[model samples]
Target: MKPPFPTLIATAAVLTVAVTVAALAQAPDPPQRSAGSPPPAHAFPAPTNLKVLPKNLTGEQVHEIMEKWKIALGTHCNTCHAEDKKNPAPDGRPQLNYADDTKAEKSTARLMYKMVEDINGNYVSMVENSGVPVTCGTCHRGHITPEPFVAPAGNYQNNGPPPAKDGEAPKLPR
Candidate 1:
């Protein structure tokens, strides 16, 4: 006698799950770092170029900050840092020269950083109960260039021009 349809379906599902679990279990373990060994590929070396950023920052700290900026601007290291043709990685990829300021974007980044610092220190601090500090991501929103803001149509309280004078016809938006 043939097995019921539900029994066959259940058996196939169980077999599929078993095969998946076995494959996952057989997968190789990720490489581990050893004591006294060099840092991994993702790790940054000692920072040589200290301009806008504080000189006291360690390589790892700078790396973390740069990673945040990278995500904020939706760009990579190559956007500001230049490629070092002379020193290529073991895999033959050109390494970034973090100190190189040949690119205009790097200077612009420094200026923007200063602006943010000033705004946060001088302006944001003055606001009552304002905990949020401005960041590159605030304006950039994951784009190299910030998108222009378009005001919503029609006059609304607080958003549009002040309430029209009692006698004057309601002024239309220019």
Candidate 2:
């Protein structure tokens, strides 16, 4: 004799759900990031006050771009982005006020970004088939300020010895 219709229907429903869940469980995981590679561009929410970069970037993309800047300038986030002392994050780290322009470094960084953009977009493109773009590292070389001059050796040279004072001998070259 056949089983009751209600019991059969319930059993079928349960089996169907179980089979679907099992199939999903067997599905492969998402791809993992390689060592030293930046996280996926869509990892975080879009940040605010992006004057140079495109405004539609995802949080992850913002972070990755910032990482590039940090490496280029040999600096951390606090170099340009100021920390909000009053409103700390839940993790106890000072929350960065990304939109604030109180720091002079932030202003300078904006100018630097514009300069790099101009160099790459205007100057670099003008060189036929030459795709080399100038960046902060081109000048900074891992330093905050690029050294303008190499240290000179020995004492500074003069045209001739100074005239002798009444009590002093004429200063002569050794």
Q: Write candidate 1's Cα lDDT for 106-172 as tens digits.
A: 9999999999999999999899998999999999999999999866666354375556898988766
lDDT of model 1, residue 116: 96
Instruction: Estimate every model's Cα lDDT from 0 to 1.
Output: 0.83, 0.76
lDDT of 1 at 126: 93
Worst 10 residues of 1 by lDDT: 28-37
Candidate 1 is scored at a TM of 0.68
* Candidate that scores best on lDDT: 1
RMSD versus native structure for model 1 = 13.9
Write candidate 2's Cα lDDT for 92-141 as tens digits: 97878877888899889889989989989889889999767898888887
